[model samples]
Structures are given as C-alpha cells and as structure tokens.
Target: MDLMDLSHQNRINTQLSKQKVGKTIYTDCIRAENIKQIVPAITQCIECYPRFHRAENPDICIMVTGIPNVGKSSLINALRRMHLRKGKASRVGGEPGITRSVLSKIQVSENPLIYLLDTPGVLSPRIENVETGMKLALCGTILDHLVGEDIIADYLLYTLNNYPQHRYVQHYELEGPCDNIETLLKEIAKKLRKTQKVTAITGTGKFSEYPDGFLFH
Candidate 1:
C-alpha cells in the first residue's frame, strides 16, 4: 500500500521486469486516467471470454484473485464505473482482507454482460522466506504488527540503502546512510520529539524509562 510514489513503483516494476514470469506475461501500465484501455485488455485476453456459444448462457463471470490489499475490489468498481457508469458495487479499503468472503456477483458491463465475483484476498499457508514475507508485509499484504514495525522499518532502511535511495537521509536531515535500525530510530525520534515515557525493567528490583516512538512520528 506504500506504493504511492510513482517513481518508486516504476523502479520496482523495472527491477521485476528483468526477472521471468510465466511463459510470457504481458506488461502494461495503466494510470487512473487511462481507464479506456482496461476493457480492451480484458476483452483481448481470450481467457477472459471463453467459448460461450450457447444462445442464453449465464453472463460472463470473471473471478479476481490476488494477495490482500492489492485493490481487486477497486479494479472491479473502476471497470463498472467505466462500462456501466454505475457507482461502486464492492467495498474498497486501504487495508488487507477488506472483502471477507465470496461476494455476490456484480455486473460491470452491459453489452457483453460482465459480472465480477469479488473474493477475499488469499495468501499461501506458508511464505517462502523471511524476505519474501517482509516484502509482503511492507506492501500491506500482511498486517504490520504480525511482522513488527521495527523489523519492517529496518528492512525498509536496508532496501533504501541497497537501492542507493538516500532521499530519506536528506528528508530526515541525517548525516548520511545509517545501517543501524535502533540508531536511525533514535535519531528520528529525537528529531521529531516523538518519545513516549514508560517504565522499563532493569531486572535488579528497579525500572527505567522506555521509549515508544519510531518512523519519524
């Protein structure tokens, strides 16, 4: 969900484009303004409208599936808006698992009669690796607390460093790239004055203050 930055998204997509995906995955970047291309793309993908030669067959039911928080519902709604000029028929949210179950069919088009089946985002039972899981978490496919924000933030720091994207360092007014998560968090906390006071156990019948802020507030 943090893919709000178009440049960052384009860079990430460029890196992924270098890797292999299936036999030949067609690539296209459609912005919100280019909704016209969506219908053509779907219609051209033979898989989208298979053999329904019968005179009165049920309307084409297209099932949308993906990892959580990838905007499946929004896509359906957008297509509906473009084709049917209708309001949203499915719920859209900024978090994962917005659609809890298989939702009833919603018509998206009138001519060919396209009905979209909105299903809840499904994740594999087991993630391949920690980094893969971290990426999923960073993309909001997984809940933040499940992976721990500190770890995710640190991973973000590492990724930014690996990408040589020091725009953060300039934004935070830091001296330079920092490899230490705690040190970076400390510097950020101090700069933002975002510290929480709480008791910390010293394990010697005593306690100390605990800090509770990170990610530049």
Candidate 2:
C-alpha cells in the first residue's frame, strides 16, 4: 500500500482501538489551525525524508524527541496528517513510553527517501531521585541528541547533589513556579552548545541540532 493509504488505515485503527469495552469513545478531531502550525516543520522534515530512505549514506535521520506531555506524539500525528494525510500505523497513547522500540524507515516517497525513528520516551531509570527524573523527563525520548556530555555531566551532578532546583535560577524562566516555554527553549539552546563541545572532543555527537524556536509556541 502507498504511505498515504497506510497512514489512513493507521488512523482508523487507532480510533477502533480506543473504543472501550462498555464506555463510549468520543473523538475530537484536530483543528485546521493546529494542522497549519505544524506543517512547516513537517515539510522541512519531508524535504530531508528521501535522503534517509536511500539504502546507503542517508542524509538525515529525523528523530522527534521531547518531554512527556510536551506534544511529541501530537506533533508526529500532525505531521502524519499534513504530510501523509493518513492514519497512523503505530498506536499513540497518553501514558508515557508507549512508543517502545525504534520505528525505522517509513518511506514518505519512493525517490527521495526519508526515515523517521519514533523511539521510546525517556524516563528515569529509577525513581530514587526526583531531580534525575525531571532531567530525564526534560531530555525526552531523544535524549541522545537533545543532551550533550558536559550538559549530561552537569545535569548528573545537579541531580545527584539535589540541586535540580537551581536549574531555574537563571537558566529557566518560571512565572511564579510554572515554567515558561520560551524560557525552556533558551535553556535548551544553551545546553546544546555545551553538549556539542563535549561531543566534538569525545566523538559522541550523534544528536542533531534542533531548529531555532522549536520549544516555543
């Protein structure tokens, strides 16, 4: 089947799967404006999709990573609808870590070749440290790319020493106690610089640079 057909089938399947044994399942379809907002990002990825599809020397492997409830699944869903205009093959849910193994090599088109790796969400290995959990949560499913060695080290130290609260001192912008999305994006940018430096020297840079203003609305 074509990618569009597969996507449509996936969406239908998802709706069917959500039907409760006794309870009714109500579907609130996505709004047009929301779809419009995510189109550019999806289009940007689509342009690079074909390269990843090529058998050898793929140009880019786009990995959508982010914290739980930060709209990773929603964003992917939007991309699927806008670009593929079909349903999803994989199931999506509110519970964390639903996307457990890597989903490799989904062809957006035959010629260009684009691949997407929808990985399991990042979670705290253990619940012993709340700070560690927060950091893991912040790093999202694609922590390998979103975080760098030095930032990881600093995050580890901060978490281990119970200084996670300090992350908000100057790095984060909180209105009262709630985090501001703009602030989060700024912090991420700063962390990226530190992480890249470490990766350059250590040969561990596998993460891709995120587009500017990605974390903000």
Candidate 3:
C-alpha cells in the first residue's frame, strides 16, 4: 500500500463531476517489491516476446516514466527479479529525483531480449496550483526544504481534517481530533522526544522557554 495515496480517488471523482478532470481510462497500483505482478505489469505497458519471433533489433527497449519517487527504478529492478532472477540494476531511494541521469539500461530478460531504460524524474516547470504543489511536496515528490516541513505538515493536517481521517489522531496518541496543526505537531514532537530549548520574554521577565524547548507547543 502507498505511504500516501496520490491517486486522490474520491477527490478525482469530485473533479470529474465538476468537469475539471478527464475520465480515468486505466489505473493499477502494484507493490514495487512484488515480483509476481511485475512482469505482467511491464508487459501490459510494452511488448515483450521471444527474441527470435521479434524483428531485427538485438533487444526490445522498454522506457519507464513517472514523477519523482514514483518507483520507476524499483519497477525495473523488480522486473529483473521476476524474469531474469537478478538483483537491482538501478539505484532507488525515498528522496525525490533519485534517478536524475540516464541510467544504464538493464536487461530484464534474455529469452525475450528485453531491456529497461531508466530516465530521470522530471516535473513541469510550472505547477498548476498551490494545492497540487503541496500534495506533491507531501508525497516527497519535491524536496522538503523547498516547500518547508512546517507548511507541508500543516497541509497534511488540513487535508486529513477535511477528509476526517482520524487514524492519524489515534496514531499520534492525541486526545481526539484537533483542528490546530501546531498543537498536533507539539504532541508529535513530545512523543518523539524532539524538544529543543528556546528563550522568551514574559511577565516574569526574560527566561528560557518551555525549559524543554517544546517546539510547536
């Protein structure tokens, strides 16, 4: 399952009703680690067959494309495992833009003479909207510092509240559904023991704040 579902299924339906989004033609979410489904998924997107039956080309080149951190590299590696019984040929990581160059094409199968061409993840220079950009940042498709963790975390809380996704409330051991993001983050920072000290001026006079330096508190 996705750490965060970017598909926005229900939101997409709403967009479709407003004629803001096109009708979905095809979609499938497969585990990158699942070798069983990888080959079929690859074949569905490209033609793979016995090399002898195919034309003059020495190998069939299959190009993989998607936004940053969308598992393009892992899919190539998984395909290799499923058909070629081999290990990873491309580097993969949680950060965005992990594959930022032309990676060496990997041979996923000998019988079919298939090769996977991995390319750098690219995004349009212009983002359509603020919300879309925030969603991208929340999904780690953009670097955290670029968008700011505080802003991203707040957006996540806003979205969760709008959707009334309370799993996070209980997960963070909050008393209940809280509307304030700062309060929520305070609780999280407390749970994680990530408090830092700060100085503040008060009626009592200038003093160190929270003693424990409770950030977001």
Candidate 4:
C-alpha cells in the first residue's frame, strides 16, 4: 500500500532506521493535518491481520499504549476526527499522566467497524541506563519535578552539542554555541525578560533581594 511505503521511508529515528520488524506499521502524522491518512492505514492493517479477517464484521478494539506524553490520546482524537468526523473524545495535555485510566471505547471508523481504547501511559520496568531515563524525562515521559529540569536541560545541551546541532545558537541570538546551561538560561531569560526578584541570604545573617531568571512562570 502507498501508506505503508510512505511510512517505511519516513525515517524519524536514526537508530531504528536500519532495523526491520514484521507485522508492524509506522506512520508519521500531525494531529491538525494529515490525520485522515492514518485511518486508511489502520483499516489496511486490520484487514491484513488473519485473526480479524476471519470475521466479516470484526469488532476491532485497538488498545493504544506508549510512554507518557507521547500523544496517545492525541492520536486517538485525531483518528476520531478523521474517520468519524468527530471532535476530541480523549483529553490531551502537555505533560505526562493526562489520561488517568482506561475509559470506554471510542468508535473511530464505521466501515471497518473499528473501536479504539485509550489507556494510561506505561513505562518499562527495566530502563536501559541513566542516560536513557534522562532522555525519556527530557521528552516529558516522566514528570519534570522527578527528574529536575536543571539536569534535563544540561543533558539536552550535551546531546545537542554531541549531535552538533547549532540551530539553537542562532535562534537564541547567541554570539556562538554555548557549553554552559547557566549561561544559556541567563541569555534566554534576558532575551525573553523572564525574571523575578527573590531574596537571598547573605553573610552575617543579612538578606539581599536580587533579580533571578526563571524559565517557568
């Protein structure tokens, strides 16, 4: 199918580009647009599956699962919009833990008789390493407070430098690429004017208030 061919060529992840897997379909879609493209591919997958093909009208119940904040709910909502011409049945959020529990099935397509189950995001019990966990945390799979934004931001800087992606330097209007997160944060806060006055403890039990730059409002 054209959908499968397009998906196979869409290499979003460099690490997995060479790896081959059977009975799996890859699709890259934006929720606001290209959502209609997903439904046909899904229908094709269901039709190709021998277990579901046995029944003429199979009650196709697809359970969507992935790490938190990877757009599982958003995907369901997009599919619903594309297939059934409906609005959002599943709620979406920027952070993790948006979908609290498994809710009722949402019918996305009528022709293939398909229904989708949106479930809470689950993490693997065994993560490969600290760097892997940090990457997940950076992607917002885990809560920011648990991993700490400072750590994640530092790791991000490291990854960007390692990959040699210097677009941030131009975007931030920096003189050159930065190796220090603190310096970058100060420049960003200065550029965006995201600063707050906070009192600090000084020597000899004295206190002084100074302007502090913060990313969060």
Q: Give the Cα lDDT of each candidate.
A: 0.77, 0.49, 0.75, 0.78
Off by over 4 Å in 3: 1-55, 197-217
Model 4 lDDT tens row, 1-217: 2223455444634435557432344434453445666666677777776777655556788898988988889888877777788899999998999999999999988877788999999999999999999989988899999989888999999999998999998998889998999988888887777766667788878977664524423
Looking at model 1, residue 105 earns an lDDT score of 89
- Per-residue lDDT tens digits for candidate 1, residues 104-138, read 98898887677889999999999999999999998
Among all windows of 10 consecutive residues in model 4, the one with the lowest summed lDDT is 20-29
| TM-score winner between candidates 1 and 3 | 3
Candidate 1 ranges with C-alpha deviation above 4 Å = 1-34, 45-50, 196-217
Q: Best candidate per lDDT, number?
A: 4
| Candidate 2 C-alpha error for residue 57, in Å | 7.3
Index of the highest-TM-score prediction: 4
User: Residue 134 lDDT in model 1?
Assistant: 92
Clash number for candidate 2? 13
Question: Of models 2 and 3, which has the larger lDDT?
Answer: 3
TM-score of each: 0.72, 0.34, 0.73, 0.77
